[model samples]
Every structure is written in C-alpha cells, then in structure tokens.
Target: MDTVLTLAADNLLSPLILFFALGVLAALARSDLTIPEAAAKTLSLYLLFAIGFKGGVSVSGHGVDGDLVASMLAGTVLSFSLPFVAFAMLRVTTGLSVVDAAAVAGHYGSISIVTFVAATSVLESAGIASEGYLVAVAAIMEAPAILSALWIAARFSADTGNPVDARDRQGLLREILLNGSIVLLIGSFLIGYITGEDGLVEIESFVVSPFKGVLCLFLLDMGLVAGRGLRSSAKHLRPGLIGFGLLMPVVGAGAGLLGASLVGLSVGGTLLLMTLSASASYIAVPAAMRVALPEANPSIYLTMSLGITFPFNLTVGIPLYLSVARAVGG
Candidate 1:
C-alpha cells in the first residue's frame, strides 16, 4: 500500500500529469483557451514518430518472440471485443441511444496514444522494459473499434439520413485505416526496424535524448486542447454522460488486466496494455464520427474522455494500474 501510494504520488508530481491537470482545471474554470489545430496536429505527429522510432530501434535488438506475438494478439482481440461490452453496459446503465452507446463504446475499444506514452514514462521510472512492437499493437487497436461503432450506429440511426453515400463512406474508411497519426507511427516504426540500431545512429540526435522534452511541450499543447474541449462542451454534457466517461475506463482496465494475465506480459507491458484499454480516441474517432455519425455528439464523448477521464488516467490511474500490473503480472 505504501508503495502504491508512493508511485501514485510520483505520478501526480510528474510534468505530464500536471499538464493534463491544467487542462481539466482550466476547462472547469471556463478559461477561453485554445491550441491551434495545426500545431496540435504537428505535436501529435512528433510524439508518434519519436515513440515509434525508438520502439522500432529497441525491437531491432530484441527481435520478435512468441510471448510478444501472444500479447499483441491478445491486445488486438480485446480491442475488437471490448466495444460490444461497453455498448451493452452503456445501454443498460444510461439512457444513451444505441448509436450513442456504441459510439462511446468504440472510443473505449480504441487505444489512446497519450495514455500509452504516459504508461511508458511510468515504466521507465520503474526501470522496466516493454516490447516496441506494442506500437504496432497500438496502431491495430484504433480501427477495429471504429468498425464496431459504425456497425452499431448504422443499425440504430437508419433514420439519421445519408447512411450509405459511397464517396463519404470510402473517405472515412480511408481515414480510419490511413489516418496520418497511425500511418506515421507504423511507417516510422518499420523504418526504424529496417534501419536497425545502425539507423538509429544516423538520427539518434533527432529522435532520442530530447524525446521526453518534446513530450512535455506537446503535453502543454494537449493541456490547452483538452481544456478547450471541456470548457466548450461543459454545458452540453449531462451527469450520466459524464459519469459514463469516467466509468468506462475502469471497466476497460479491468478487462485489460484479465487479458494481460492471459498473455503473460511483463509488468510494464501489462500496464501499458491496460492504459490503452482505458483511453478514448479524441483525435481519430471524433474525426471519423464527425464524418460518419454526424448526429452523435462529439462534445459528449470527446469532453468526457479527453477532459475528465484523460487527466484522471494519466495522473492517478497509470500508477495505480502499474502497481496492479506489478502485483498481478508478477
């Protein structure tokens, strides 16, 4: 208990957590703050590249293993299946329509890159190592939930109009699979894999050493984005909807812990998997929903996930999960 408390304290003291807190506090205070969309986009790209490239380099030395494959497969399966559970839970627990329930569930199904990054920091602080191809696992998790959400939305929102337009459908599909963040992440990971450690040598100055520093700066921007999202949507969200945001991550993390145990992941990897399971997609899913399920409230999902739950998971939840992973993953 002392150890858990200490780690939790450490998490709260971290700059990443602080930045996230700033977002929540600023939003709750109704600050008129904004992060430029272009800059936020660029920061996200940088974060993905730095993390993916580093992971690729690490994997270059580690190579692939059976357990790694098992873990990835487990993560993928969880990503695909968790939404149905979330959808069912939401329908029963709240008054959300099938479309809203499924849409929110899809966010739970997908992975959150920032949450993963935060977990990686916690692991590093604990002097633990995780597999790099988990980056690939992260990429894989993003799309399946989207399909699940769309499937549910289509079923419920037949009357929402223009459900089957070819051009729009194809574009959203392409965006889902080939989204810039996912593309850059996978592309950079593969490039680093191909280049190996030798490749890292050539660009180490760019992707290494300064990675965490860049994360701090990017998180500052994320703070602003998150704050803005929450403040603007504050009036629109009901308590049940907001409560759904908070509850979903806890449910998802419990499911993730079970999955991690089945796959025999290390503490670091297990915590990361749990974090991914708990995180919601502010970027990809919102964009996709805007294109596809236009009636589904972005503010409800985005604000609840990004504003409330994100800071919670980043500051308090990651360390809590790490402690749990250490206990269970051992």
Candidate 2:
C-alpha cells in the first residue's frame, strides 16, 4: 500500500502528467493554450510508429511462442466479453438506454493506445520489463468490442430504428479495422520485425531518445481535450454515470489480472495487461459509435472514457496495478 502511494505520487509529479495537468488547467482557465491539430496528428503518428516498431523488434528477438499465442487469445476474449459486463453494469447503475449503454460499454471494452503507452512509460521508468507482443494484443483488442457492442444493441434494443445502414456498417467495419492509428501501429510493427536490431540502431535516436518528450506533449493535448469535455459536459454526467466511470476501470483491471494470471505473465507483463484491459478507447470506438449507433450521446461516452477514466488511470490506477502485479506476480 505504501509502495503504491509512493509510486502514485511519483507518477503524479512526473513531467508527462504535469504537462497534462498544465493543459487541463489552461483549458479550465481559458488561457488559450492549444496544440495545432496537424502537429498533434503528427505526434500521434510518431508514437504509434515508435511503440509498434519497438514491440516488433522485441518480438523478433524473442521469437514466436506458445505464451504469445495464449496471451493474444486471452486478450481477444477479454475484449469481446468485457462489453457485456460493462453493459450489464450500466443498465443496472445508470439510466442509459440500451443503445447508449452498449455504446459506452464498447469504449470500456476497447483498449486505449495512449493509456497503454503511458503504462509502458511507467514500466520503463520503474525498470520493469514487459512482453513486446502486448502491442499486438493492444491492436487485437481494439475491434472486438465494437462487434460486441453492435451485437448487444441488435439483441437488446427494439426501437432505435437502425441508424446504421448496410453501407454504413461496411464503412464502420473498415474504419474500426483500418483506422489510421491501427494501420501505422501494425505496419510499423511488421517493419521493425523485418529490420530487427539493425533497424533499431539506425533509428534509435528518432524513436527512443525523444519518446518521453513527445509523450509529454501528446498528453498535454489529451489533458486539454479532457478538460474541455469535463467542463462542457458536466450536465450529461449524473452521479450514477460519474460513479460508473470511476468504478469500471477497477473492474476491468481485475478481469485483466485474472487473465494475466491464467497466462502466467511476469510482473511487468501483468501490469501492462492490466493497464490495457482497464483502458477505454476514445479514438476508434467513438468513431465507430458515431457510424453504428448515431443516437448514442458522445458526451456521455467520451467524457466518461477520456475525461474521467484516462486521468485516473494515469494518476492513480497505474501505480496500484503495478503494486498489485508485484504482489501477485511473484
């Protein structure tokens, strides 16, 4: 417990989190600080490429094995199933309609790339080594939740009038699978795997040396976006919704820990898996929701995922996960 608190405090004070705080504060105070959209997009691309490539390189060295296959399978199951749990919880805890609940559930079930990156950064800072294949796990986790959410809506909701046409459904599938982030991440991962250590040597300075700094900047933009959401969407977030946002990550992390234990992941790998499971997708899920379930409220899902869960995961949840991993993983 003490170790958890210490790590949480250290994380809270880290430059990345602090920069994020600065953006939130600036947004709240209306200070007009903003990252250009194009620059933010470039940063996003850089991060995906770097992390994916590094993961590929790691896998190249480690080679494919049963453990990697098992981890990927476990991650897919969690991604497909977690939305059901989240949907049930939402139905019982909040007044969200079946469609909205399913939409929001998709966010919880899908993985957040930024949050995954943040957890990796925390692990690196703490000198913990995790599996590189987890990046592939993250990519695998992104789409299944959308499928589950659609299934839930079709099965449970009788009256939304099918906002998604067959054409829209096909487009949504493409968007979910071929989103810019996923494409860059998986493509770069393959490139790195092919190039291996020699590639890393050639590009270490570009990807490795500047990673933390780039992450700090990206997080600042995220903070600003979160702050604006929290500021403007307070009306949509009732007490039940607020509680759900805060509660679901812990629930997801517990499910992840169970999966990690089953797969016999190491402490660092366990923490990363927990973090991935606990994260909510603000990127791909929302776009899918917009196309597939256009009636659902973006404010509710986006604010819950980005404004509340993302910050909590960064500031407190990651440390607790690390502590729990250390205790159980040993």
Candidate 3:
C-alpha cells in the first residue's frame, strides 16, 4: 500500500502528468491553450514509432520463443473476452442501451497505445525490465474487442435498423487493420527488428532523448481534449455511468493479472499487461465506433474513456498495477 501510494505520488508529480493536468485545468478554465493539430499528430506518430522500434530491437535481442507466443495469445483472448465482461457489468449497473454499453465496452477491451507508452515510461523510471514484444501484443489486442462489440450488439440489441451487413463488416475490418497507428507501430517494429542493435544505436539520440518531452506535449493535448469533452458532456455523466467508468478498469486489470500469471510474465511485464487491459481506447476504438455504431452516443463513451478513465489510469491505476505486480510476480 505504501509503495503504491509513493509511486502514485511520484507519477502524479512527473512532468508528463503535470503537463496533462495543466491542459485539463486550462481547458476547464476556458483558457486559450492549445496544441496545433498537426503537431499533436506528429508527436503521436513519433511516440508510436519510437516505442515500436525499441520493442522490436528488444525482440531482436530476446528472440522468438514460447513466451512471446504465449503472451500474444493471452492478449488476444483478453481483448476478445473483456467486452462481454464489460457489457454484463454495464447491464447490471447502468441504464445504457445495448449499443451504447457495447460501444463503451469495446473501448475498455481495446488497448490504449498511449497508456501502454505511459506504463513503459513508468517502468523505465523504476528501473524495471519488461518484454519488448509486448508492443506486438498491443497491436494484436486492438481488433478483437471491436469484433466482440459488434457481435454483442447484433446478438442482443433489438433495434437492428442500422444493422451492419457483410460489406460494412469488410470496411470496418479494413479500418481496424489499416489504422495509421497500427501501421506505424508494426512497420517501425519490423524496421527495428531488421536493423537490430545497430539500428537502435544509430537512432537512439532522436527517439530516446526526445521521447519524454514529446510524450508530455502529447499528453497535454490529450488532457485538453478530455477536459473539453468532460465539460461539454457533463449532463450525460450520470452516477451509474461514472461508476462503471471508474470500476471497469480495475476489473479489466484483474483479468490481466490472471492472464499474466498464466503466461508467467515477470513483474514489469505483468504491470504492462495489467495496464493494457485496464486502459480504454480513446483513439482507435472511438474511430471504429464512429463508423460502426454511429447511433451510439460518443459523448458517453468518449467522456468515460478519455475524460474519466484515462486520467485515473495515469494518476493512480498504473502505480497500483505496478505494486500488485511486484507483490505477485516479484
């Protein structure tokens, strides 16, 4: 408990979190502070490329083995299954329609790359080593939750007026598979793997030195976006909705812990897995939702994922996961 509190405190005080807080406060106060859209996009690309490249480089050194394959399988199972858990919880606890619940559930099940990156940063700061192939795990986790959500909506929801046909399914699949973030992540990972240690050493100054600074700025932009969503969508945030938003991540994390134990992940890898499961995908899932479930309320899912859960994970969930991983895996 003390270790968790100490780590949480340190994370909350870090420059990345502080900058995010600043953006949130600025947005809430209606200040004019903004990150240009292009710059924000560039920062996101750079982070994805850097993280993916490093993970590939690590894989180059570690080599493909049973552990890598096992972790990937674990991640896929978690992603495909978590939305059902979330949908059941929402049905029990909240008044969300099946479509909305499923949409929100999809976000929870999908991995948030930014959150994964943030966890990596935390692990690095704590001098912990984790499996770099987890980047590939992250990429693999993105699509299954979305498919699960669509399945749930089609299976349970009575309102099938806007039913997704075979063609629609094809398009959604294409979008998920070709998402820019996934492309850059997998592409960079392959590049790094092909180049190996020599590639990393040559580009270390560019990707490593500026990583935190870029992350801080990107998070600041995220904060701004989240704060604005919260401010505008306050009316939609009922107690039940808010409760689910806060509670679902912990539930997801528990599932992740089980997965980690089964796969025999080390403490750092366990923490990363827990973080990935706990995170809500504000980026990829939301984009997919906009296309697939247009009737589902964006304000609800977006506010819950980005405004409420994202900040909570950054401030508290990561530290708590780390402590738990240490206790269980250390």
Give the number of the best model, judged by TM-score: 3
Best-fitting candidate, measured by lDDT?
3
Pairs clashing within candidate 2: none
TM-scores for all candidates: the values are 0.92, 0.98, 0.99
Judge candidate 1 at residue 231 and give its lDDT: 68
Clashing pairs in 3: none
Question: Which sections of candidate 1 miss by over 4 Å?
Answer: 26-35, 156-158, 165-170
Off by over 4 Å in 2: 163-167
Query: What is the lDDT for 182 in model 2?
Result: 92
Candidate 2 positional error at 196, Å: 1.2
Model 3 spans with C-alpha error above 4 angstroms: none
Q: List the candidate numbers ranked by lDDT, top first.
A: 3, 2, 1
Model 1 residue 45 CA deviation in Å: 1.4
Predicted structure 2: lDDT:
0.93
